[model samples]
Target: MLSTSMTSAVIPIRTVYGEASTGTSSQPMNGTVVHEQQVRTARSYQAALSDWKRWAADHAYALHTIQPEAWSSNGGSIAHDKFSDLDMLIPLLADKRIVYLGENSHGVAEFNLVKTRLIQYMHQTLGFNIVAFESGLGDAALAQGQIKMTATQETMMRSIFGVWWTKETKPLFEYMKETHKSESPLRLTGFDIQVQSPLFQNANWIPSNGLKDRALQAEQEVHKWRMSKDLSGFRKAKRELIKVYEELLQVVTKNENALKMDYPDEPHIVKLMKRALEDRIRVIQEFNELCIQSNILTEQEDYSASQSMMEWRDRAMASNLAWLATEIYPEENIIVWGHNGHISKAQSLISTMPKSMGELMSKELQQESYVMGLFMGEGQAAENTREPVQLDPIIPGSMEDILSAAGQPYTFMDLRYRENERGNSWIFERMIASYQVMMPMSLELRRHFDGVLLIKQVKMPTYLPHKVTKQIG
Candidate 1:
């Protein structure tokens, strides 16, 4: 049995979040933090459920719900055939160049299984040909570069974070490996600029020993920044890494043709590499600033800085994702996988947060993209992969409560309906800040997601024994 002594979500008195926090706490694992006044703790849950049922039934969409059993993975089989219910998603999403699949938390078994199903569905049915993870841009790129001839499950597994290397996620890797030989096979890419995978030796963007050495140094320094209790050597590390990245930036600009020559078969390789380098520099700067103010600033000020630091990451991710969609895979539709906070659009207008990747792409792509957010009503989230724990019950009258009241174990709804429509239309206008099943925050649901997928009860993932080098949420 899971421990009841722990919480599904961690609600601190007032804590700031950094990427390394790797938790749904210190703010939240996925989206913006929720303050007491920002959340409406009283709502008519039964009425909302009845109204939602009425809306879904009027539309004749399978109760607009798919039972969890229908979405299950094949037991130890490479073929994940639980796709009969996934066709329901086709019409709900926009026919766009990119569709972002955002998860509330990464470590849930159901979230990974369901999302893997969606990725496969979108790839085969909707022609979203690339699956870009929220991992190292270069690492995933190099990993993909090896996919056709020299790759294994381990190659793809190494490309992503440790949280995803699970039994639930194995089929996706198997599918990727199996399909690489087929015509127009699905491919992989990534948008994050951070270096997580230790594949720096394979970098071919530049032949500079200095650049390669600097990236390794930066990776080590970043490790120190995350692991060091005293945050020792940060200032000096920041200065050296920034100097190296800046100097390398000048070289990359000067030798753009060399990079193009290095990847003559790929489109926009030079620019993508440049953006990867640029974001690395900026992210370091942002992280450095956030860390400095973290200890010295007042509670609110620290929160603001921490949020901005995250936003900077969102901006960087947006830039790289745009390049992936428009330049790298110009002829192919793409699917992006990331955290809901990074994918949420509501941050654009919120004074408390900066523009998120969702907002950035919404502005850039106009009607050419769809961003979806995932949530869970109850049960265990493996955000802490080592020891699975239950998420706290959602606040009684919060929006999650209202959404959870739908008469199904799993439910999906498109957020395209006009807010002015009567009966359950309050959903569009309703502000719901979700850390999946954590403390509720405030944001108009319609503004944050084009659609939502809710699994009423979720189970934590079974972690891989040897693959996980360290713990992550």
Candidate 2:
């Protein structure tokens, strides 16, 4: 039975004629008129379950259950089986110019490991040369230099990403270092905004400890002047800070020709450095705008301004990705790593938000972009809480529930190819949240992602071996 709201909602209808008149009278022909409605009746819980079972049976080939051991075996270096579904999936993924892999949260260790291994496999077999991350551009550029120099995993991890500093990421950093030394070196880049304020404080920004200390001292002086309401002193400190960034940019740009001539073995690193310099300049400009807004905007307007800044940030990431695809690695395939929220191709439920980075990329790349979303059934993840919390059970009628009922420990469903009409309807009807509780108000799963990687359970990411301290620039 349909609820009042369901029945009252805009139901599509089709009209039909009961019979045709044999006598062709221009104005006085009488015939029976019938309204045949094409209504989509709401299904009961039992009905939906029955439908799901039928749909699952009809599309069995498209659903694959991945063995957990397959992923855990050999420390994520699973030996490829010619008949394996995963083996088949890789070739399909290789066809795309860009592939996006999304995680539910940054704190999922299991997911991260799987992603890292997948990246390695893709690079080894598919000729993907560049791996773009969600970290600040300046930070990634610094980490790239460290990796090239074969820096310790600890140093590389600490220097690269502000959010991804966990011990679980150690393997990935080590992989990058090893790959950087190879004849065909893989490139690492970042396509996010420079969120770190007083940018020099970011460990990834400056090369040497001396420059780091000098930048820190400059930051301190600027803060002190601001606290004292000393405009002249604050302006002087700000000028010094900007000058340092400008001088650094000049140094990097000036070495371009020399780097190309002397370091012809790895000329790509110089290109990355130039990109980082450009991003730093943009960060300074954004910081100045923030200061102006803080002084002039009202409380309500201030919130609006922040929202605008966030939208601008997403746009900036999209722009950076476009630049990378066209100018940097035009001939090579690229892989993008980011959270599901940033990479979903659908518009966010929030009315004020614009289309996400994924949506923009899909629009620009069209058939060339392949997006894969990762979801978990039940597990622990870090969210708004300080510690990791247990995930709620899959909600009935949700995408997770349907996928869970398929009885797969791990599964991959390709959204592009579906033969059963009912199965297509079931999969496309709703979008599933990575975490069960964070389901969106509305979503079209088929429109957002090309494939789904479902894991039965997950674990919280491990922190760095040493005492973990959160650093905010």
Residue 102 miss distance in model 2 (angstroms) = 0.5
Give the per-residue lDDT of model 2 (tens digit) for 212-310. 676566544433432342334444556666676566666556556644443333446677666765665564445435433433453346556545555
Error of 1 at 405 (Å): 4.8
Global Cα lDDT for candidate 2 = 0.59
lDDT of predicted model 1? 0.64
The CA lDDT of each predicted structure is 0.64, 0.59
| lDDT tens digits by residue: candidate 1, 347-432 | 66655667778887746574777877888877887654456666876554344555665656666777765454545554555444
Q: Indicate the residue-level lDDT of 472 in model 1.
A: 22
